[model samples]
Target: MADSLATWMPPLASLDDALLRYLDQTGVAVLVKDLTSGRFTAASPCAPRVLVASQDIVGQTDAELFDAVQAVALRAADQQAVALGTAYAGEHRIERHGERREYVVWRHPVPASGEQGPRILSCWQDVTEQRKRDVLVQATLAQLEEQQKANAELRREMQDNQVRDSVSGLYHRAHFEEQLRREADLSSREQREFAIVSVSIDGMDQIRETYGADSCERVVEALGRLLKANTRAMDSPCRLGGDRFTVLLSGVGLATAHSRMEHLRKACSQHIVAFNGQQIPFTVSMGVASFPHTAGSVEELMRSADRAMAASRAKGGNHLTLASIQFVPAT
Candidate 1:
């Protein structure tokens, strides 16, 4: 009975017609190949546009119609699907009619007929436009990323300029004060030690009278460079006013702070300002005050350092004085 039914079974004319209609409406290309012979069995009308011509492709192996590279890829995909008994899908680039085109190809196992051996059904759709769009989008995203990076760098430079001293390129007095306040708050909360060193240039009036404001400015600039060179990376130096500067030393004890101030003093004493072919010498007097040792707040620390600086100027003009450390007893 099984043999009789197989012999009298009608051909799948309706199913074939339906499949052809579906392919035409969807613009999909279909092809079937004999797995044993590696020859094309059927090609849909849309197959020619995707590089599979019905008249020339029938009964032709991929090795015959494609170049070595294309043949290798097609055969590999075909073998993969056959061995796994599963569908394989991939994007491939094929050259047809002197133009390169991209297609999304799929290979699936097909049941064999009585006369035909094992077979595989293959289908593909043109994806050239979609691939081009994807490439364009990726390039556009890369360009946007580069532009964003450049913009961020420019903004950082602008912000740095805004907070920096124009003449010395160090933090301006305003920015330095803000930073001192922040550090003071942190030190108070964390119970850490920090110091503020105030420096005053002695006899600036005489220098201005003898040389001029420009000469005085040059001297201040020289002193600023000397201070920066002598200071540590964590220290911040700023010009507080005419002939007055300040430094905030974080995590420094009185001994270390005094040493730092002494270094600055030596550097300032050595710095000579040249104006009108004349070498003019200057000196700086600094005062150091630490957090919780001298004062608990930013304003008090600055005041104590300022008073010590004035005392240093009275004593000589180029000496450093450590402010009296007043520590509050722990509760």
Candidate 2:
């Protein structure tokens, strides 16, 4: 009769038992717990090596092994899964053998028969290395962003220093020269028109003699501020030297340059420097020159403009002169 009963048993049940044994021998841990009682009902032999205190937790709740907060959180998660009739999978950290370890956990509800109540099956795998890798990746990304921001700030500072005048905080002569060369090259290559205007302040030596060097510096700084306020973005205004300024205007002809110079002259006439409660009025003489119409090369163009400026000063200061009228073409 016993043999007959054994023969009647299905092969699937035997296969399941064999599979469970195989998992245990292969070091794969398995655990089953009563949902209502919160006690472990089944624990494979391999569970002890993989999970801390696996043998002691067979008939105990999480409160017996973990802190009250962790136990409460675990119970809440299990209750939620049982209520929803679904599986819950997530990562968690646990203190085991005086060290904190990370684990990947999966929780599933198992339906029971009439004699048995519902239970939960909980499975876990160590993921400490993976967690560490994720932390490292985040740290690396933050570091890269910081480095990029620093590099951008440095580039902006360098550009600002390159364009700023050392003495007056205005555009310097080097910047203006570079702009003139660039514009001249563009004009010659693209057949476009551009203009250069040069201005020389009158009576600078008289001002220096009357006031100290510091006062002279103050006047120059004030003039620089005025030029910056008056010039457009397309116009490069620069302090060429003591009492000398230059402007490179893109896409402008000689006539337009002359008109712009007149406007600058009017603005300068209206400007007054206040020192020690005294107002000092100043005058400027300017000269205008256009590319291809005056002369070739930046140096030659500047020379022609200088000659016109000399002519304007010879005619008694505070005037705008066109270099084209006196421009001599190079042979």
Candidate 3:
């Protein structure tokens, strides 16, 4: 189709003008580049929409019209399309008037005719708004998935009466302990490792004293939503009373657990709870420990994670700490 568009030519100059006029009426941005001279030979009326704002581009090279970097990139793409002898499609980003714009372009090589050397027939369309809409759709889908998970968790709680806290909607400590035991047993049988994280809300007491009691609940709810959104179905998020929480990551190593918890810690630090037109800021400190790697028993695992969490809190919070692995000397 691109080859046909490039090679289609009428025998009369009037028909050529008519063809360009028709393309202009259709609002298609089109330009013809003389490959030998590396200069644009012709452009449609709508070509300015994709390229520079100048109406005249007939005798201008890419370097004269676009910025240095973009000019080189455009020239390289043109050369590649010509060498391949086929149509090329690509997306390009261009900054104009302090705003970034994205464009999708197709370039096809036209055969030499008469005195005219081989030329590149180029077509482009602005896709900035389309790309924005795609991003918006993806974000919306993610939010919907999070909401569905929350609803499912709620349904499970209603069926089994397992929820511990009303505000955060997280599992009870007993339920979390049961899950942890089951995970340990499964990992032991499968010869794999799982991770556990101890979480503590930093400055919760100060926040409660400053912003009143309800402010602390607001932060807890926000943290619960984040935990649910970030965790998988197999993982468990539990509130261990007060401002403390724990997460059980099934079949995860210490490094992976630390990375994931670090992201969560950052999210918590950035999150602000709004109440009665006032903003309450909060942060969390996390400790990541793995099963059989950091501790051999549940009692030792909780203590190791707790010690790491204390260390993170000592560093002024909003940090994630990993428990050190114990090495035994060979006899």
Candidate 4:
């Protein structure tokens, strides 16, 4: 059987002149489709213009005008709209003259008069440029968010580098002091106790004299690595210059703090510094002081820990000492 719509349509002389003229002059594209035959019965002059085609579109099905995939989509929508006797509205993409275009289209189904069969009234508006602009805007927004995230990460890295020691990769003296003051304030306000452990290498001066400056520096670096390895994530480890190190253990007592430092001391005693083919032995004395148990203020706590560490070093090198609390008048 013939598939051409002209074979189903009446003679060209029977067309309504007023309607044809009106459609020719109208800028909007409109079409009437025979739902039973699945072919266009009539198309306005503007319909051909919208498709960038100079030939008449009356006999052309979507399969002739578009690729197979696009035709299948359009046919499905048209069939459903006609079956339901309702309006269809959607976006459709098609390739024309080797370029892709988007359209906002609507199809309205209506019963045909007498022998004309079922009909579909369809119209489309070009929306290709608008969709392209929307895509570009979304891409730009995503790039901006990524850039902001990178900037935030860079700022955090720079701040960390500023407060880290070059030799030990531990907190610098100023950063350690800042943390000390913050912990002291927290402890006072909450009436909770926290511990601070001070560490010093025993006979460091004698080791420097015997091993030379290079060996002494290496020993300091080694101790810094050991301390960092032994401390917990919540603990703040700091190198306070020379052979001195400190750890601020938040929410811990003198006993637990002393236990942790004793393990570190044991590690240090077993650690060997091999230089110039000679094994050099080293050990650290640690002093533990708690906020309410040892002193009230940061300055007093530091002094007590320092005095205890000095006492331990004087007595024997590899020992841990607990500081006795000193009374001070409330300010």
Q: Taking the tens digit of each residue's C-alpha lDDT, what string does model 2 give over 1-331?
A: 1122123222213425565567667555566778778887666666776667644657777888777877887888788778889888866687877878777778887787465578877776767777899999999999999999999999987897888876666677778887888898889889987888888887788877786566677777777777777677888988888888888888888998888788878877787888877677777888888887887778888888888888777877788899964447599
Give the candidate number with the greatest lDDT. 3
Candidate 3, 1-331: lDDT as tens digits: 1223334332123335566657667665788888999988776667876665664787889888778998889999998998999999988898766788888889998778797889998887788888999999999999999999999998986865645568788888889999999998998899899999999999998999999998888989999999988899999999998899999998899988988888888888888889989998888999988998999988899999999999999999988899989776799
Give candidate 1's whole-model lDDT: 0.81
- Which residue runs does candidate 1 get wrong by more than 4 Å? 1-22, 52-55, 97-99, 200-236, 241-243, 259-285, 309-320, 326-331
From the highest lDDT down, the ranking of the candidates is 3, 1, 4, 2
Worst 10 residues of 2 by lDDT: 1-10
For model 2, name the residue pairs that clash: none
Per-residue lDDT, model 1, residue 215, is 83
TM-score of each: 0.73, 0.59, 0.53, 0.72
**Candidate 4 per-residue lDDT over residues 258-303, each given as its tens digit:** 8888889999999999888777789999888999889877888888
The window of 10 residues in a row where model 4 has the poorest summed lDDT is 1-10
Alpha-carbon local distance difference test for all models = 0.81, 0.76, 0.85, 0.81
lDDT of 1 by residue, 152-234 (tens): 99999899889877676678888898888888888878878998998999899989998887888888888878878877787
Q: Using alpha carbons, what is the TM-score of model 4? A: 0.72
- The window of 10 residues in a row where model 3 has the poorest summed lDDT is 1-10
Collision count for each candidate, in order: 0, 0, 0, 0
The parts of candidate 2 lying over 4 Å away from their true place are 1-33, 36-88, 91-105, 108-164, 169-175, 226-235, 255-283, 294-300, 307-331
